[model samples]
Target: MIPWDLIKGGMRHHISEHMIICRPVSENTYFVLRLTLSYLSTQLTWEEM
Candidate 1:
């Protein structure tokens, strides 16, 4: 039989790894979107901003 702690630790490690892999791509897109929105807002009027 396997230890419960080992299973939990493995699952935790896997979730952290997935987050590490996915977080950067998401963050990059979010940052770019925010920048684009800010730029457009500056170029446009306050109503759209």
Candidate 2:
């Protein structure tokens, strides 16, 4: 199984920005997407940032 720490770290650093931009599409989907994106962003790098 994937390590939770790694997964959470990735989302906070990488995917949060992407989800913030996607907010206008749909509220319900946006919420879910934001959660997933935020979760993935934490594991990204400066290049990804």
- Highest lDDT: which candidate? 1
List model 2 lDDT by residue over 1-49, tens digit each. Answer: 8799988899876666665575545655867887888777765654486
* CA lDDT of each prediction against the hidden true structure: 0.83, 0.71
**Candidate 2 accuracy as lDDT:** 0.71
What's the TM-score of every candidate structure? 0.46, 0.33
Q: Pairing residues by index, what is the TM-score of model 1?
A: 0.46
State residue 29's C-alpha deviation in candidate 2, in Å.
0.7
lDDT: worst 10-residue window of model 2: 19-28
Per-residue CA lDDT of model 1 for 1-49, tens digit only, reads 8799999999999876875687978867777899999988887886566
Candidate 2 wrongly placed segments (more than 4 Å): 1-25, 45-49
Candidate 2 shows a clash count of 16
